[model samples]
Target: MPWPVAAHRSRLLLRGRILLDLRHPGAAIEELREACGILDVEEAADAVRGPALLDLARALRESGAEDGETRRALLRAQRAAGDDPELLLPCLAALAAFHDAAGEAGEADETYERAVLLAPADGALRCQLLTAWGESLLRRASTRDGAGIVDRAEYVLREALKSLPARSAQRGRLQGLVGSALAQRFRHLGFLPDLFESRHLLGQAVRAAADAAVRAEVWLQLGRVRLEGWHHAGAPVLMDALQAYESAEREAQAAHGSDPGSVTAARARHGSGAVLALMGRPGAARSAYTAAREQWQRLVGALREVDWADVELTRRVESEPATGEGRTRAERELRDREEGDWERVAPPWWPWTGEWSNWSEFDRS
Candidate 1:
């Protein structure tokens, strides 16, 4: 059999294996590597098959192959394909994903921009690429421009929304991505508009998502938005959010047969605890917080045994909160300050604003 034909056959077989054996991570990784190797051989046969080579590069990256191998594969394909726009977009998108994973934010940003330019009319593609770019910006915001990057992310998401076909499956996914982007922006800017937008979009996502895991994630985001930013209103919103996270967690465990990091269970527990505390349920809050703190501590302890050179692991480590009494004190103080600030500056129509003081007093009575 000719090498090119064999490689094409191998690619097809590997893709089938990937779709059929999603439960086996090891099998998926093996199939991805097989696909990558076949594509490399095909590239040697005909250097101009840019799209095929780019697909191989993306497969390798997704399989957690070595960064150098993935980069070399992509660069060779890009050089072979030259300036073909059809070839460049996937190449750029794959490179963006690789660079972002490798912590090369600047390179990721450049590649993502190129990818967006290549496929400006494809909303779903643009949304996926911009989400990658936005995440990279969020990661390195302190060193190279902050709010501006967030603003750009907001604009990109809005533009992506304009391209979405209403009531379509693609639009549903795009809505979740947009909502997530808006939530991140709110975290950065503390703007009520962003929060409101995020809430609205996330609500849409929850309604549109058919998958339990996806719906759960949308619910988790909505919960975090309310609990963290909306002054802990003691409304039913927090409970609703908790239910969503719990549902997601349960579904993830059943499907994956383990905690698959689906909903960030520890964070959910802590947030639920915080909400409970604010609602004058100290005992339950304490239990929930203790569970979260233990989980976080165990994660930190596990990390301490691993090599810090693992950039992805290092990133996870950086995200873990310090535990014990110190964390409790800090969390309480931060929430108090935020609540006080909101009380002073909240819009008149906002439920927590003092303009509703008489109503609130009556309700308390």
Candidate 2:
């Protein structure tokens, strides 16, 4: 006999409850696998199953499952569920985020563009999508297009903030994201004025963040802005920026735990190392670079291994040149070579007056 309607509904609801309880990331992924197994066994064409399946796919994506599997599951569920636009939006957003994580910039951009089109009135989602879109553009821009992307980023961020309620908790996070975007814009333009604004906004974000990890990110960005403008400061300012980055790193590490897959901690280490290198402290800079490099290398390796297929993300971590020591050696060699040549031809250019023979000897002295 066909299953009773109420009994089928109860079974589906029970399965959903089981999935919801699978909250730990690892367990959630396993639950998704189990859900797939259950669906396969049922093999029944029931419209009611679509929403539950979509939820399962979303849970899998958020839990850090491979993108291909998540996309396939979401697409199947979405199609079976009659492609409801509202239902599709979350899956689209999740897919876009997955592609972004995987470094598939073109795919991510396209997905987010479609998502924004679907939800035109969602100011916050639009802003987040636009910021991400602008980031991809900035990465790929030749010198000609980078500035325009930055401008778009700034406009979108402002618009998003304008749409938000004044007391929204998301305001702080949005401000931090905008500040980071502005700092990138300034860095590309080599303009100091924008950086001042960036620093101010980042300071506000730092004060407003309730989460330790988010606060660390704000402080790290602030340190980066200060370090970039370090030429304006003496040793004291440089030291202060270094301290800020170091503190940020510690806090991020504490909040995320060691090996936390934390982009913030990795970035903080890199920023700290760069500032140390600029301050002429090679040993400390090398140590920081080593940590940053390790994190970046792991991420890159993960990407290369065809893991994290849902999102396409790329990161470039730079370290102080190992050839820095060689610079001193090269300089000494050049000076010795010049001295040898001079010794051989000293007569006419005696006392180093050859290049300035027209000047009076007293003036030369």
Candidate 3:
């Protein structure tokens, strides 16, 4: 390939990466898909092809596209990551997320377990993995609290938090996660400390979050904590719950003028209605509940309409192609050339059990 063409393609690909990092997945997908097209027609190495495919897969998955095309992109990336498991790890993670978005929780958990199994011993990778796992558990807890997952999430996050500097955004994120997990546990086990700590950590998360919607989510979560407190502790804290719920509503309204299909926003609206009812304002409570119900219904409708796209193209490309794998070496091949290779592949953990599957006859304690 000509230097000019390669340079142009690389530039586009880099721009796509920037867009993704900047939270513009729709634009990133368009640019990265274009870059993939350019590299696909040329004699690109797997190193080049793999990153492009992986990045594009991420863009697709982030945009909530879980169709045959997304799966194909991830599978091509899996093949490209054949020699370097580290490269393959992210593909698996993204695939798991895709499954989660598609409402296939069983498959999603299994895929994530595979990623955990293949996770490199690198600290950053492990931290990211824990973050992903915790987030997954939190998402799954929408139906039922995964007490085991929450316990493990808090443990893992504690370790990860120690590595991050005080007051950093990453640290703040971990704090928020731990708080969320604790709140789930509090509901299941009635731990007062968990409820109180949850409120504190959620407050910190709201302060640290740069995105308005995220901050709104934190406040909504805090509102839940207060409500839970009232339910478990009695009427003394009913006013506290009402205040928190109103705060949640104020934050959510400022974040999105309309409901915006956010589960957090819906819950906030509902919380406001419940709080008003508790405060003896039936008319106002009815209005709040009606608004909340309409928003909740809209969210359900949008979720049901989600569809996968471009399947035949994806499936056919794999069957017709004979892809080369000459440049599929791991990134560590270059980075750790002098530092010596890591020879150990640690055992994978079981999400349901919160234990390592590779360890035999080991005590859980």
lDDT of each: 0.54, 0.57, 0.61
Ranking by lDDT: 3, 2, 1
Residue 57's lDDT within candidate 2 is 64
All candidates: TM-score: 0.64, 0.61, 0.64
Stretches of model 1 off by over 4 angstroms after superposition = 1-52, 55-63, 120-127, 134-148, 228-263, 293-365
**Model 2, 1-365: lDDT tens per residue?**
24664455456555554655555545555544555555556774535455556556656665777778767876776576455666665556655665666778778778877876775575555555554554444344323345656666666666666666678776666677667667777756867777888778877887777777777767776786766555433223667778778877887877777553455666667667656555545577668767866765665655532223111221222332432343453353243334452122111100000011110110100
User: What is the lDDT for 18 in model 3?
Assistant: 89
Residue 311 Cα positional deviation in candidate 2, in Å, after optimal superposition: 23
Candidate 3 per-residue C-alpha lDDT over 7-107 given as tens digits, one digit per residue, 9 for 90 to 100? 98989998998887787878889888988888888957777788788778777866877577778987887787786875776767777767766778778
For lDDT, candidate 1 versus 2, the one ahead is 2
- The CA lDDT at 169 in model 3 is 58
Task: After superposing candidate 2 on the true structure, give the runs of residues whose Cα lies further than 4 Å from its correct spot.
Answer: 4-13, 24-49, 59-67, 77-85, 120-151, 232-236, 257-270, 273-365
Q: What is the alpha-carbon lDDT for the whole of candidate 1? A: 0.54
RMSD (Cα, Å) for all candidates, in order, is 12.3, 17.1, 20.1
> What ranking of all candidate models by TM-score puts the best one first?
1, 3, 2
